[model samples]
Target: MTPETGRQLRFAVLDMQVIDPPTGGSRQRLLGLFGQLGSATAYVGTWDWRGQSERKQMLTATLQEHLVPLTPAHFDAVEREAAHINGGTVIDVTFHRLAALSPGYVAAARAAAEVADVVIFSHPWCWPLVAPVMRPDQLLVYDAHNVEGLLRLGLLDDGARGTALARDVVRLELELCRAADLILACSAEDVDGFIRLYGIDGTKIRIVPNGAFAAALSPAAAKEREEVRGRLGLDASPLAFFIGSDYGPNGDAARFIADRLAPALPDTRFVIAGAVGQSLAGRALAANVRVTGAIEESAKADWLRAADIAVNPMFAGSGTNVKMLDYFAAGLPVVTTPTGARGLGGAAGAMRIADAPSFGEAVRSLVADAPLRLDMAAAARRAVERQFGWDRISPATGRLLASRAARRGPAPFFSVVVPTYCRPAHLDRLVAHLEQQRCRDFEVLVVDQSPEAWCGAAWKHGFPLRYVRTDTRSAVIARNLGADLAAGAVIAFTDDDCEPHPGWLEAARPAFDEPGVVGLEGLILSDKVGDPEWRSVTNDGFEGIGFMTANLFVQANAFHRLGGFDGDFEEPHFREDTDLGWRLQAIGKVNFSREAWVFHPPHRRTEERESLQARSRFFEKDALLLRKHPGRYPALFRAEAQWTHNPYFREHLLRGAARYGVTVPDELLDLIQ
Candidate 1:
């Protein structure tokens, strides 16, 4: 089907990057798109704007721009200093997820969307910030500068930032495509990537390729160009220029120009321009090469005016190269790799496209034939002016404002309550496992009941967290406290020592959404460490049996209605979860979501010692549980021991005494009988 075209519509471009100064290529793409798009306002999301004004001047003066501010909760100067002292960061959350933690940005995006016909997310990262609150009337456009997931993989040395960042980025990009009403791809390659990588509907995507977005140059005359060259102390040698920002691909290209291309031809003068020069720090370059760390626009124009030829040896990166467009716009005869020519291969007739091994030969041919260089330069200028110009791109994007597709569903928020008492190592392990979860809609509440408070591990995990310290050390009390402070519709319960599965919440969400499912429980796979520490809770998967709060979720309304786990079931924290589960089951349905599981490793790091004293404490708690539910409580244990707490409690106590070859102490004898 033909794309609906020529229908005029207003656009609200939502970008998370600080576009005012614009460091990267994505910002340049956004700026170029926003400048000419009729009746458009770019809402740039900035969470940390401490010294942006002093950094660089902005060009948003020519267009409408509203800054959507969202400062993190207590990421002060002190916290930043603490992070440095801590060796590494406690939390490794992405900026987009961090923005989701801010309700202010969500509200701002929603309010801003009301006035615009279409909301264009400049990159995949911006989608999570606005998708949850997107209005039904507004169209969601994902402007795919790159198939970010694939691009991130090719960036840097495989695992420079580790697998977590790359994994999260890919997951985020997948969700962005599913949620977008329309996706604006930079190349036909990027379009196929979305379809092949995620298998999204190819029809919803449109190619609005990158264009010549550089500023108009001043003083292109021979004397002006020669004077600029003379200022740089460059001789009358033929200049071969390559310009780029400090991205990994650009860095590779810069190094290519300095190492590979220049050493081969000492007679030809080479200049590596822009922030890309910083990558060559401390490295010796070829004598023919001059590295300009970074330059202003006018300085760039001077190099373009004076340069004999342009070259791009880039091997990695996604999307069309904006630097290639800049080279074409400046009327320079260019030589580049096929990887460098990705979407711009249509301009091959006007430029030289070669593979990596043959890139030197291509550049040499252009540098040697002066007449051929003049012809290629004229052709490159004509290509940008006609086919690759912003003027052509604007009309091709009109269909994005006209199209509409079904929006992806928002993930449900859950308050994951962890009743922790000491074993900071266990808490750290749990934090790592929680961060690995595919879902990002949950917040963790670590109700720490350690004798010494853990100096607050709040905001130290990928998820939003609250670390609370209490003088009273009780599992029942911690659960109650977490429930009281919970902002989510569902309050999920898991122990501090347990490692929840990554899909635990994603699997649990559906069960809670069902009608009358006031509370639910999940499978607990007990993992024994060396000696058996406690009851290996590998629940036999029996129906109506494994309602242990080791992995549980209860509807907030029903939880508060039942007064949240009876506090009387205090210390050796035995039957509180069972008591609450039974109580909730009486009021409404308590279910089991089999796939929503957690690993219940033994309390190896904990001080839950096995002794007569500990056994006596357990017996006392068992007596309390019997008193609370005389009929139901006994049914759970042996039929004979179930009648009363004395028989059941006495057996466990005597059995514990037998292990040490001693009878119950005289002082405690009467209590057990």
Candidate 2:
């Protein structure tokens, strides 16, 4: 866990403001990651001055808390002036300055990266100025928060210079990606966009979603709302609040609610909050429309807690809506435009949706029906608690980054087919190991015959896995069932009881690359074998045949060509795979790879060994396969009567063998005749 120890990942977020720090969803996520990887050094680059006021209040306070004071020097004088004005102020002063002064920022971050193992330059909007100065390393990560500047420069509007710049920015970011060891994005949408835009491999990108902040979650004082409501003299009215005012979309939302909706519902008062443009704030306000004009930070949560409904009439924006997430955490029902709820994915069930035309009606309906409003309120709270909260998000984020992120190559994207019956313990281990794999372009198909357990943990691991249920049991049939749902280009087979080597794919992937190789065999390295007498005693006891589908890989298209497993081979037991291997060999090659190995857990007892199918059904199925594919095993079916007195089987096998295209071997046939 030491910074200089094994595989250190240094994060250099240059030009990422430290003052108000934007206090947006992205900041919350960065803080969460910092908490998770406490070992990594975070180099935060900022403008010389944040702001006169925010510097005094937030920046100074935070710096004073973390850094010790010293006597003034020449550089200290500059630092004092810069610190006084370099924070979260609304004016473009800090950002413009930060954009202009990135030389110092680059120097600081690069210095930090020298001693560190990884270098990450992020905040696409801010660090373009510093991109030229960054040093290349084995682990460089670029975080693309948004493609905003392109949209604003009118270049993205048409085939102008901005379009060229947008194209260049995308090209540059891609170049940066190829130069780095890994890349991170806040959403899967961003990750996918970068892949398409930059032509980087999809495996290189990892998604770490923006997290919620504590300010949104801490309960507000009930009396704070009472004071604000009393000041507006609307104590009798039900409150509904809106945040974000300076942004054009925020202003439009304010007007939409005040002009279109406030007249319809006099009993409900709409409070337009946050720092507003002077002109927009003074625009035609109704008696029930209260412009709170950016409530004090301390009172923001109180206002959210007081509101019966929160409205977000956003017309444009990308990325998850931080305000909506904050509202949901406060347990308040919301009426939001489609654009406002974009990317959260769970907002449809959590909020009331309304466009500009229906906006007024939607707000009034919720105001009139208290029960409907309260139900939505409860749903929103549950959505936040279950899916959107930081605690829930952090764990999933950690699993993906630590277990599956930063892997790319010519690795075979294979689907693993695992069939299980009452093997919950084995199923859990298989999934956990799959999740931990350094190479993850694979799907796990689990066929479960355990009606009692319902594949409890296997389905809950949050990976690319599928589960199917069946009552009748046959290992071959179960495997065939799993193949039906698999989506990967190549199929890898492993039994529920086997533990694949970490490099199993690294070793076996080449077989698929081999021309005309259809079915490849994987060795089952078992330390313990069932008793030989017992293996012999069980009818069709190829359970010890030891070739596991559990460790085999096949081309999906080729597996489909073999018509899946021969279901007619019902032994509650054997010959299904041997029959399958030979038939596939008839079409192509079946090469064995000693390199591909899996450890089959020690065998269990006879009582545990028996599958639940009745003996009568087992005998019928064994008879059916022997009849259908007699050409593959001619001697066993034809001479059954001469050597052993199984009259029913001999009669069926001879009639069935002739019915099919199988010819008895001449050497054995002469003796039998």
Candidate 3:
């Protein structure tokens, strides 16, 4: 969350990029989740080398225009880098400056540890050096984006130098899993492999698969076909295309296609795409073979449009193949190696799997059988449009983030309960703020303590607000009463006096996705009256101190389960919110969302303070705490309350008993009362 403004969870991503792609892959993957959750802040760190067009082209092709050129200078300046992408994009780019081999890179990354909530290492190779120095408060999530590859390149191999090196790398990754607060695996198989390989608990691992490209050129986009095919001059020919060029497996496949596949059929022309600036050995310049340079993303569809068949003669590679999805997106019948089809759950039926020699035969077979080719093409189009598109893929990302934020269960609509008194102008302002909010999924339930006439002006505002009237003066009772009428899956309670940011709901909503997070509270601060510099803890402009009820959102079922706020305390008092927070904490986890904040105007009254003191009497008396809730709660209540300096408590409460003219029970007064 912006610390002072109290909106958006800011995350700094550390990775290498050669150029930004026009289409979204990693950028879309991360940003789509950010848009759904609306709290994540991404800081991409890329290299600055102007040379190596191959590296630049791949990065540019993959990232398009979304790439941000970041470097060691950017890393040095970053106060804290939260999340890690590891080496997912390790095509031709090197982590030269950020390598553990270099002390400066390590130091720059280590410096980010000072300011992050979570510090993730994309690979195990860097974790042993990085994790030991990070703040204890910061959570470390290892993006095992490379788990399957790590095993294929590590534990499964049987060599001395290569095996030992892979083993060390695997060991490092396993160590990261052990030390991290969370381990994120990209696939279910990877998750299982990680658990089996590292012997880590299954509960600690999260399955957040990589996202697909965002462009959804439906099979019906004939304009894309005409435009792209016209540019490539392929509309007149029976074009057989094979993408993926430079990687070891792709290079091997390209050579195999040129040397083996093209020779078998001189009547059919083969177009090889993907490599822009490199040449491979064994590439035969036969009349049937044509090696076209990297195709523009816009023209990829056209090539697919003119193609008779798409062949993926991959010899090796361990993870999910992104090209298979691209071929599916282009609506082409694909012929792939087994390695190229890994982790694509249901996409197997959409394409034919063949080895290098079989790949040549499969292409020949497709050319001979028009009906089989047509069926496979239809299946590929349906598979991509239905199951492999970004629209289908992004929801899983949302669910993952939401699960992490809420930490309990699935997401539900939030009922934001605003308890108003005599402040009509403030209520109007709050209402206006609420109306402008980004997440409009929440319902506004305004529980007014005053007469209907006082809220008449607010009633005319025409916002979709549900009004509930109660003569009860106790804010605690009103909040609890509000809970009974709340229809949302989650209940957010904020005071009428506070002015929330437009993104407050946007920021807090994602925390619901976190595992074990049943309750979400944000940093609350006095609105504009405090010292500007000293107000925010980190000066990212967030009021980092309070988690007031005025800015708290709770799951509705959990809220009702805890019975809402206790009304025994005085109206507008301090301990009531803390009491509710304690109760909710007893039932499930309470997450402090740095992003979900509201601006509470500084207002305190002695009557409210005295009433709060009376509530503290109940908390201080161990007997009352024991009787009110079941076992194992009083101790936690004491700890969190003490740790946060519960406003209702005073050191004097521990000593005074007879002064109140009441005989206190020994258990309540004795033992650190």
Candidate 4:
């Protein structure tokens, strides 16, 4: 919860790109920052990238995972006609059209905004969808990868049409700055650009530099390097590798190298890698240059290993050079224009800055001096491994997000639903625990099933309490009824026989608010005396959190969507909660918390009751549970026939059957064995 408003740090994430494969630096930056944040907080988002239906959620362990699908819009002829008439370039027109979100996405975002504490727009382009839906008190964040208004201007030719197009982008960017409560700029240079060009407040900006997965890269093995060089049909001479996507600046840089730099170094082999090579495909080039169009990552790694040097000739662009980090990670010394080395404090000497006029000289110097290459390569390796890895750099942004996010939103509210039978003592003990709770933003709902209210007419509590008497004796029905009458956004269910910890409600609030999480299972510890006779231990499996009704918290929205546990399972199968828990996993994450604990004592029963429980007919509930959740039953109950029951309890059940002169069926007898 926030230290100021005391709200849980929940997020409604918005993105325009898919980050699972993360093809470029911008995508990697997003995944490094927001993807890791899923480990702690609840976050949900949407992306309208066409044919991205395969990605249901961001690639990570977020509140199980859910994404509201947004419609993908493309630039059409009508939009082009309008752009032509208005004197706007196709680049700006395409951007403007793609930024517009469909009504479906808007509605979902509005609903998410209502409940979430923060709204994150990955880039300013798609933020128009979020602007109108934001609540006044909600914290809004803008992740500025580049000074986009200035960047787009460079994508087009120098003319009034391009300038006019840039002007519109500047206006939208300014609007984004005004809406954002916080801004994450890629580098200090980007921070200055935002303030200088758009006049954004410097106080709200943070310098979160781009990162690479450095640990995944390594210097190539000798045999593998030889094989790769032989396969590419390149000579043993100094091979300079330059890889880039088909962005405008990358094409210009590629053309510059093919037209000017490569011809100067006739003895050297320059391999132009990735989509940028497509721009140089048809052009007449030097015999020493080789263009490979858009290779796979493995192939890219191969080229990085085979090459003697890494080169980037880019002279224009905003944001830090993500590809430069790859060079550092691969133990390659880089020679690039100053623009290509942006954001990394000269990359700790990994990159040697040189202009286009002297590009050939820098390569010749590195090729002539082997020790210089080794020294730069070592520096590059150290820079990536020690400081610039995604694992190393992502935490700072997460911490900033948490600290700033903690200052907004309201305290979480819950409706504690206690279903009681005839045990007034157990109900009293449970209520006493609730009264001493550290977080007081919840109400108690006592759904009494006992005849004439066995909780007593004199029952009382400090907070607001609702005592509802129901005729239904079924646990499923009682929970469903309590859910229907629940006023709080989250519905927490605890058995009358269980004593919840003082911090149970408080511990559960954060998990419920986590992205994609619908159900929260807490640790239900055993507080029983007669272990062999009666077993109530529930804290065994559940991957860490148990789903037993003795301790469970369900988001009211998800609970209602699942119809609050099928009441039919209440009759013969007393595993309604278990069935519901398994089904809930199909929709969203069902998380477990070790902190929210409940102590359940063994119930004292008659010999007749014990015999009835041991009968073959009574074991049908297990078969019923198995049929309802066929796939998850094994994991839920383990491979054992008698799940959760100890060996002593199994023996006791068998003994009870013999004492009552009852013969167990062959199938039922296997459970005791």
Candidate 5:
């Protein structure tokens, strides 16, 4: 089903707090995304007085909010668990306690997940609680605000306790990544971190930057800005301001402003707002620095307008700074460190980037020169509109929702069938690779055709491995036998030599959502093929409907309808995959996915001579294929020719090479012609 043919998707977001006032960047991002979806609901855990009031006023045209009251007992339980986990060291236990203590939150989230086509969890902590309640068909997305493990590790003072907690956090994060169908990272760096730290496939992750809504800067807000400034009783004195919720990084930034920047810029009055303001109030301030303890959401715009310059002296933080985006929305010139301006990328050019020593000077310079400040303010506003505004960011979320909504029916569970003959070592590697797959629903069926049952060693790798021995020395017969014994809705095929990517199953699972799609061919990347032409062929084949069993997924019923692979081709062990592809095409539509990739190395030492001899027998198999399906071979050959010249094929080859960290010669393209 196309997105236009389907009903509007109902989005449910599971978060730790009510998003009416949006406490931090994560909540703000969720609110912005939810607003764009139109039919959206939020299942939030409200633990405090602030959240309770926000929950009461949460009903709106675009969003329906469900609040789960988290009592003091919940906090106590979480603290106890954290203390036990960390050997009695009191660490940040909010996330750790969330899944264990908040039964009401979990129950509410589960209810939301049942009806919604798409369910988004705000953090990894919510995954364990919500995952069990989610239906198999629901598209689970993780809106990762930061690499929480790394963030927590950075905040810890006790090394041993920190390491222990970090390890636990990393494990939980990995589990969450494995559970999620798609992970929405706050920045590109977080995406890279997931891949680098946990070996998660990049295809499953996407960058959805944190941004302020464009409505914050709309014409109507200008009147409110002036009223707020007047209400605050701000004079002509050039006011510099900073605002943040009570996070470790925010506290450090506040301290930096109080101790370093405030003392240097004595002539300018600096206002510190939000939750962090209370912490800074006790600190010795330069008479010029004023702490407005926890400014209300209504007064935030006025505070921003009252300030001549906005400052973010953040030395530490993992994700994009939402406060910087807010400052830009308020049309205030920003002076932030490179660290503070991390995910802004090109937008950072609009702000004054400075280090610790030079931060105060940059702010003072902006304050002293009205012309420079005006130029920067204009640039900042333009940057926000161009990049850091919800108008630009929310559309990506909309597109993702629409695409997922287009898929019909419950998600099919896969039974991955690997037909191995005599190559025990290859089977071992294949099992190891399968164990790393992010999608955990699938089970492995290793159809071993070896004389001896050598694939038994793979059982220790775990994840529901079924090893069956077939006396027949045929890949075709092995696959059919495996399919007969398989219990999943879909049967995915891969040779023993092929190493499937971590996200291969997750990426391929979506294709079967379309009832018409009977088959899916995943990209086969090989560095072993010495010929540039063959490599081009590998890339080209990725787009073609013609399937290769090296990496293929087909509906179980469709496989049965096709009568499985022809047992006649068992001797040669060639063209059986192609024959099945033709049979599947005759029955229903076949889809291709480049993201579901597998690396197929060239023939090993023992098989090289056999493979060489098999090349000579290809014509016999080709003849049989042509005779079986009369007049189709010519069209198939023509389609192959078209695939060879496809622009995407060349791009795919280059991208594949880059992914493997291999450099292909430029002359290879010249040879393609």
Candidate 6:
């Protein structure tokens, strides 16, 4: 820990490229991470001596820099190798060369890793240089901007060499994954890929998403927008703008826009900015198209302000687009492909999702309608404020660092709490699953709210099982009653309908070791497809923010501190867990564990009348919840509305209802609306 800020640990970042200008996604993430950790040093490699002095001056004030100058001969050799690889269909040639570090660069990275408490490798290319020097005690973190192997494979054609290259990349990536203590993925999709492809421990991975440095970009006033537009040249026409570095994906998008889209929409002026502008240089562009090569950081906001709509016609990309975030921050309505929208999580709602064939029309539609553009721009800006704001995202990263520092001795004993209401079969199955848990030092407490004692037979289980009966019919009251009786230091909660995975307790218990973490929620996977409830519950985007009672864990002391769940939410089971989560979050951090798995099988409604009544009760409870949290209601309502109307969501709802023999009346649909 540093002397000034005792909580934040000192971090040293090793990167093959100097992140002075912070143009690309990798550099942007480096700047964001270092900005969050005040006391940090960055060891960057310089390509040549031409701009060595200028590069040093361009380093961000937040980071202490060490630039390792590379000889021209060494740079040429690496460039030659990259050029050879570029002859094949490898997408990110520049990124691949970073892995080929010289001996001098390796020594500098090793020396820096020795003094730092945590050493972060910006990309897998920097991994080998710092991995050899990493001490066992020092935490090694890999900030995976994208799944490099998958990106390469996507760009490659089907052939023997492609297969071999793909195989080698996967093998290398797996080794890098195993070497790091923690891996920060840019998106949940990357996390899923790692788990599926490499079988890496999910607990060691976190979603430290790419976000816009909007705060760093000065807000463009109305006068500034007008002035910038005047300086660029008089333009009353709607401008479709895109800005990106000279990466393959960006170059592809720029070519597509200049060759394909711009000709069709001749009325709209297409402005291509950044290094990608060079790719469109000699092409016969439409009269409306303009290529502005590499605008400075100071002029970025002005250019964005002058544009009417931001367009990302990306067909191939692995991670979240930082340019989309920048567009939102600039209050420009965006139109992008689903590929470009990947890893943006829920914030993708703000942008118009389209495919390659329909992308031009999407941009044209936004340009034609001023009202729609304004609404989208407003929503986009709001989404950035609520979700992508650095204030909200940075602390989550800091918590990861703080957790590493707070990890202690042997795991604490756990008290697993299950609140059931007249569900004997579900409770019995749940107990059987608990019996199969890998960790044996846990007690199961069942608080039954049934009129009669239905789960009394669970006492015969192999583990310590405590069954209690209560006359009340409230899930909240039952949870509070069970927490009071719990003897362990940690209190874990799961619905009676949920079946804990064999390693569930073993995976969730380690989170408590992290400092300031009061509550933990495990990944709740649906046992069956087309389960309507599973759509929102299984969304990885809601990892840190949302809470689900079906799979929740909280510290015993924190449970008592917050007075358990609110009694007002007892009758209506809806939002009761959410209300408690809000309170818990206020006091301390509540983490999400992708490893702590629980399978929630959809429960079929035995009686149609009861099902309608339950749905009505859910709506009633939701209304009360909205009244309680007035400020949060609008965003919650918008999110739910968006989910409800989504084609995939609707298909699930219809299919699940039919499969489960559940009937949805018109009244319920109207009520939901």
Query: Over the full model, what C-alpha lDDT does candidate 3 score relative to the true structure?
Result: 0.55
Question: Model 1 over residues 56-98: C-alpha lDDT tens digits?
Answer: 2235543455565555452343245334434222122255656
- Model 4 is weakest, by summed lDDT over 10 consecutive residues, at 655-664
Please give, for residues 456-550, the per-residue lDDT of candidate 4 as tens digits. 43566776676767555656656655664555678888888788888888888888657999888888888454355554456555443226888
Per-residue error (Å), model 5, residue 424: 57
Instruction: Write one digit per residue (lDDT tens) for candidate 5, span 1-673.
Output: 2355456677777766667667677678767766665555555555443234324335456567667776556666666756654644232334544445556656776777788878887777667666667778778888888887677677663667556666777777888888887777766567667777877755456566788876765322556656766788866677888999877789899899888877887888888898887667656788888888787765777787677888899988787889888888878878888788766643532577778987877787778878767666776776667556776566546655555555454443998999888888888788889989999888777888788988365547647676777555667757866775555678899989888999999999888888799889889887645543233125444365457888888887667544467543444456678888888887688888889999887544345443433344343344445545655654554555533534444444443333222334444446444
Q: Over all chains combined, what TM-score does candidate 6 have?
A: 0.63
What does the lDDT come to for candidate 1? Answer: 0.67
User: What overall lDDT, based on C-alpha atoms, would model 2 receive against the true structure?
Assistant: 0.55
Rank candidates, TM-score, best first. 6, 5, 4, 2, 1, 3
Model 5 pairs in collision: none
TM-score of every candidate relative to the true structure = 0.54, 0.55, 0.49, 0.56, 0.57, 0.63
Which scores higher on TM-score, 4 or 6? 6
lDDT of 6 by residue, 515-612 (tens): 99988988888744454433323534566545788888887766654446654454345566787787778768898888998988754444453343
Q: Model 5, residue 303: what's the lDDT? A: 81
Q: Show how many residue pairs clash in every candidate, following the order shown.
A: 0, 16, 38, 4, 0, 0
Off by over 4 Å in 1: 1-8, 21-24, 47-49, 52-62, 69-93, 100-104, 156-161, 218-223, 403-673
Candidate 1: worst-modelled 10 consecutive residues by lDDT: 84-93
State the weakest 10-residue window (summed lDDT) of model 5.
Answer: 655-664
Compute the lDDT of residue 247 as modeled in candidate 6: 76
Model 2 C-alpha lDDT per residue in residues 146-176, reported as the tens digit of each score: 4333223322434653344455555555556
Please identify which of the two predictions, 4 or 5, would achieve the higher lDDT against the true structure. 5
Off by over 4 Å in 5: 1-5, 48-59, 79-101, 160-163, 217-231, 404-673
Model 3: how far is 510 from its true place, Å? Answer: 36
> Model 6 residue 571 lDDT?
34
Tell me how far the alpha carbon of residue 16 in candidate 3 is from the true structure, in angstroms, after superposition: 3.2
